[model samples]
Target: MKETPIIAAGLHDTRSLAQRIRGQALRMVTRAKASHIGSALSIADIVAVLYGRALRVSPAAPRHPERDRFILSKGHACVAIYAALAETGFIDGSLLETYGADGSMLMAHISHKVPGAEFSTGALGHGLPFGTGKAMAAKLRGESWRTVVLTSDGEWGEGSNWEAALFAAHHGLDNLVCIIDYNKLQSLKSVDETLRLEPLHSKFEAFGWAVREVDGHDHEALTKLLEGSPWEAGKPMMLIAHTIKGKGVSFMENKVEWHYRNPTPELLDAALAEIEGACGNA
Candidate 1:
């Protein structure tokens, strides 16, 4: 337990938490001259919902055996995870300032050494495979805690994930839930331009998984679907979350270049104002 009070009074809502996350990630990335702010922003709401009220985790004891495991397979966007952890009391809010600094636990990519991260991942295709193994292990041990893997839509192009998909279905790891951040933009270009993943829902269904699509930004819709989906027995769940590349910021929205661009000081000011305005609207 960090013992430091982090959550603001009257800030228990997931939407508010998400706004804080975007602001925090933008600052950390800009200070560190780091990339992936766009990647982090795209999934802020998803991660916010998870950390805000969905994940069964404890800040006081992060490794609690019964806690649900969350793996951010799209690790380049770890700024979102770090922010969520801090916002949820999993780590000292001040430690966020150390992000990407020398000797900082908050690496540019996800690090298990961080207080709440279950698995360290940066390579695109590794998160789902590892999470699948964890789900299988839990099943073998007859544990109830589920494993949720958040992956980039681009990673679906990886042959390894398909193999893992087959493995999970064969073993009936219904405890596994995979959320794809279908932002439609990869590192260099649009996903369609880099490697197409169209007909994505059918592909997962063919792999023997139950599938659903959701507006990745609609907090209510995401909460409903994420909280109640796996709608069947004998199969894993795959959620395709359609999202904009850089959500929340005016100029960055849907822009691929933001994938590798760090926010300038001026841009940071503008982005924070935009997010704050959104918070006011909410």
Candidate 2:
């Protein structure tokens, strides 16, 4: 097994981390004959940044009360999150080899049963409320911990999400932060064609939360956004992270067909090559 690097080395740029994890996730899914490659790729950078630099977790003590919480609302992309957890030393990296396999802890959806996962999530529009409840609990206990939820753009169509949005705003849960992976592509078609969520930033703002839009792939922007609180004193924060589906993969980018395709060996090799090149350049 490769040794985990020191967190302070400053060698692990979020983009490189995302690329590395995405490569691992690709291998995991391909070997398992699983799907959701595009969805996993879409949020890789954000997950990389969160687990690599922002999250407060202990690999040895994942249930530490003071630790920050991360809920993957877009749980179909658990491959990316699992890869991030492995890279961060929260789980044995080799365990990723069994991803999606029968009897494997690494399922296709997020599971709190995993060492680093804070909540079990897969159903769309469920994470916000769950994260809100956690944030509220922290506030009640006067803890400094924060709750962050990574949501999919397509999840905006769910009424449950809007209900949670309104509830979070009403309570002014400042410790809660929501990051939307705005890749603009859903399972069967483009988000615009399936259900237009245009003017997404405005929608969040109108709901009484603070809003910021940024390039989801840009690590620096993501780092800054994660570090700072943007919502009003009593409001929850929302970040509309503009991203590309199947980002960093040449043939998969913006191609909806890749959304559910298990990567063939040839495609996996090509994807790894691209990630290797990016890591080398970085």
Candidate 3:
């Protein structure tokens, strides 16, 4: 499919935005002495594309009715989403420093208290169903708004996800889009070893969703897939975004240990350097 002119024009800027968010997320996690840095990095690009290019969100009026809805199913990775929201002007960037702090609005997981965030989610398997309900509501109201759900490959183990998947297909909620961060590694081990969700694409197809697999870190590809509406009529869409767990950092990429390890000051500096290099190249 040809790139829409609007999407093409924003591709570089969106990538730069994502890279910046990744850097900020890394710094936030490091400063907070928290974990999930790897998961946060894994979905940075996807979050950027959603907020920067695709999602119809109002910074000044985040609750705008016609606006699209986004649910971060893997809420542990919400640092990236929060960074994107701040960068997009939906919230204050200064608030990022308080992430995970006591009594802070930004918790370790997502919270609806944050403007632009549609739903608060940390428990796995909840986001997909919530998004499905939102999409169904939109459909019932004859609204054109879309609902996008972002989940990790690891979350597939939850039976709730499958139930929602089946429900969405049965209801033919065409406006719903599910993006899977297939970064290979989960918390304990690789996704393959954890549950063996191989042939993931076919599984979605079997559930009656139109499926497309793409490089999660490729901004242009993500933009095209999202904008193109690869799904058929009367079907939901699923994009399996194959990605690296710790994408931008050299030593952290594909390393399972980073899943729950807080980056040291030196490591944080190195990761920021890598992100800066990526920005320059973009």
Q: Against the true structure, what is each candidate's TM-score?
A: 0.94, 0.94, 0.94
Off by over 4 Å in 1: 1-11
Off by over 4 Å in 3: 1-12, 228-230
| Model 3: per-residue Cα lDDT over 1-282, one tens digit each | 743222111233787788889988998999999989999999998988888887766676687777788899999998999999899888999999999999999999999999989899999999999999999999999988889999999999999999999999999999999999999999899988989998999989999999999999998898888764536899999999999998989888999999899988988888899889978886
- Model 2 stretches astray by more than 4 angstroms: 1-12, 228-231
User: Whole-model lDDT, candidate 3?
Assistant: 0.89
Q: List the residue pairs that clash in candidate 2.
A: 172-234
lDDT of each: 0.88, 0.86, 0.89
| lDDT, candidate 1, at 32 | 98
* Backbone clash total, candidate 1: 0
Error of 3 at 152 (Å): 0.4
What's the best-to-worst order under lDDT? 3, 1, 2
**On a 0 to 100 scale, what is the lDDT of residue 263 in model 1?**
87
Give per-candidate clash totals. 0, 1, 0
Q: Write the per-residue lDDT of candidate 2 for residues 196-279, one digit (tens) a residue.
A: 998888888899998989999999888888874544688899989999998888888999988778888988898999878877
